[model samples]
Target: MNHDSYPDSYIRGILNTVKTIAMVGASEKENRPSYFAFKYLLERGYTMIPVNPLRAGEQILGRHIYARLSDVPVPIDMVDIFRSSRHALPIVQEALTLNPRPQVIWMQLSIRNDEAAALAEAGGMKVVMNRCPKIEYGRLSSEIAWMGVNTRTISARKAAASGGIQRLSLNRASVPGGATEAAAAAERMERERGSAG
Candidate 1:
């Protein structure tokens, strides 16, 4: 897709479908941008798996860190790449080797790898280069418009929730559905496993 500006639905469809993301290059340091992004995604009900060789075996935000994409135990719906542009291709290549390959490969803001994007797209994975899910979550969910500012309305619980004021579900990252998230994730992974098998 065009890095400059893609369709809103493209972004929405990703955020809606992917429930678990493995964030490569995540930092345990609290002051880093990746740190905040990780926290935000967690708060929004995303199950974030941190992937960094240096921090492997440690915990970030209560989630154990994996040394590489292949080390993650559970299915990762998306691989959020936080490395430099030059590193994206290798990461995407590695991501493609997973049992249930991630649906999306999202390179962080200021990071784009056209070759990686193409490779991933060719492998049937959606690509979002030079973008961050945290930012997209706000724009798509209208959190900037209604999440925080004084709306002064009393019966706006659902509205606030829609704006992502609440944790999990009903945001850009979730689709309307029944059953628990665990069940949904299992079902999704099972379906993909079957297709791959």
Candidate 2:
């Protein structure tokens, strides 16, 4: 898949519009990235439905875990996947069969299936590949301060020092100031898990 296929505007639009997310493969382990991501989204006031067959009937973050996306009782704005790339297509297929259908199919970092991405896009659903909702929320929503990033401080300082002119760059590295390191580490862990599994 072409990396440029996912334009920033498209992603921003979806992120801004999505209010609820179905977290496929959400785990009970608090240390897992998916767990933290789900928690982060929930804290941000986004309704999160956990979809994990093994954890079905269990509750994580007070939300009951379902065996599959189709089991979700309410409408889902987005489907955030935490499974491997090889397993993504089936989940996308399942999400597509929903009555209202999800508006977006977000494959977490290191998890991307071209066929699945294409299918979702073809169905008028936005597709986000090789990305994490937690990371994106921090980067795009001005919530970097909560993530322990000094973007607000640094940008404010620079603007104050520059006589009220913000010189921040549009580049991802320069905007959130510097989150690539953390994002890269998360991606590495995901890759390791992918390889191990």
Top candidate (lDDT): 1
| All models, RMSD in angstroms | 12.0, 6.7
Let me know the TM-score candidate 2 reaches against the reference structure: 0.74
Candidate 2 whole-model C-alpha lDDT, 0 to 1? 0.75
lDDT of 1: 0.77
Model 2 lDDT tens row, 1-197: 35323444555567768988999999999999999999977876688999999999999988999999988999999999999888999999998899899998998877767788899989988888778878766655445555566432124332212112322222232233444576567666766665454
Give the poorly placed runs of model 2, Cα more than 4 Å off.
Answer: 1-6, 145-197
- Backbone Cα, N, C clashes tallied per candidate: 0, 0
lDDT of 1 by residue, 1-197 (tens): 66545566688789888999999999999999999999988988789999999999999988999999999999999999988878888999999899898988998876767788899999999888766798777655655435563211122234334333343233433332233466446445543443343
Off by over 4 Å in 1: 146-197
Candidate 1 C-alpha error for residue 53, in Å: 0.3
TM-score of each: 0.76, 0.74
Worst 10 contiguous positions by lDDT, candidate 1: 150-159
